[model samples]
Target: MEKEIDFEKHLKNAIQEERKLQVSFFDLVSKFEKKISNFDFENNSILISDYFYSGNGQKNIMKSLISENKVNKENCREYSTKEGNLKYDFKGVYFFLLDNKPFYVGISKGVIGRICQHLKGKNHNTSSLAYKLGLLRYEYLNNKKHLGKRKELNFVTEVEPVKQFLQKQKIAWISIDNDEELYLFEIYCSMKFKTILNSFETH
Candidate 1:
């Protein structure tokens, strides 16, 4: 008889090992660069495989280049940003993708609350005008601010036409605990993707 494998137990063990490896990897990487430097941890993790490590080559190449340049104040300044702790409790960074390209990149301890603020436009998350327009409920469109300079307020004015543009959008995210690291990663993603909705200068 074939022995039954405890898949759930196996997965739990594998997850624990991955956690240990992740911590060790972060510690080692931190030795080379400042803790808040822009490193894409999630995508890099996905590139690793059982046959060969994809990230190792890239990491080495980057390290060599950085070594030649010498990590300096300017480099650190370019990558680091300071942000306040989130009021909600869903720690991670997220991306709103439109047509498979990043439309906006942001980080928050409370993903749902932050996303709500963006869509609902109640908490000064007006930067994501595209997202807000797409997700705003019909009931909330009464405000003239949402209508903009259009003098003619019409019947059935949920701005349904604008909503169509945001179709085929998707969201991707990775959990991050450290606020400084989260800020750095978000900045990095914004710069990499060049998301029009994100104001990188502000972080």
Candidate 2:
């Protein structure tokens, strides 16, 4: 008979990998903060930078807002139980960079989960990164003309390619403890960065 897969072992390994990634990303955040010493900031803003894909070129820098919860051993304990979890919730507002530009700003309580969804092209709603990129590609092909049947077909076919292109894009984020502040910060970043992937209008 075939051997059974040890799902519990797999989950433990995955969590460990995720924790390592977060720790490294946080270190990158610190370096970016020091690099941008000259920029003025709002009350909660913090700066972070990193390459979109691992083994890529130079990192991109962007601003983020600080959250009430700080990442420490007490709060951000790594996998230590059978449950195998990261102690701190990976909650935050995150930005997606395309061609070293801020393309989207979003808030997520499960930061990695949300980013994975975008990378996998798992969401298809209007606000989804995949959907928006598909729309951008469709528009580029049409050059702002009315949607036609062939154009619609073309758009549908291009979604995968768009996702593939974006899968390697880099990201930077900061935690926001409160949901209200998270949304507000997302809006603030969207406006400040003039991010193209944001659908909601904000002043």
The candidate that achieves the highest lDDT relative to the unseen native structure: 2
Write candidate 2's Cα lDDT for 1-203 as tens digits. 12235777777788888332323434444444343233223322322222223333211111111133223223221233235644323567767765555678888765544565565533464226776677768779878743555334343576656866765565655655555556556766677778767768563
TM-score of each: 0.41, 0.51
Q: Give the per-residue lDDT digits (tens) of candidate 1, residues 118-184.
A: 4433222332544345334433554334444232322134433443343334554555766666766
Among residues 3 or more apart in sequence or in different chains, the pairs in candidate 2 whose N, CA or C atoms overlap within 3 Å are 52-170
**Considering summed lDDT, which 10 consecutive residues are worst modelled in model 1?**
44-53
lDDT of each structure? 0.46, 0.52
**Cα displacement (Å) at residue 67, model 2:** 22
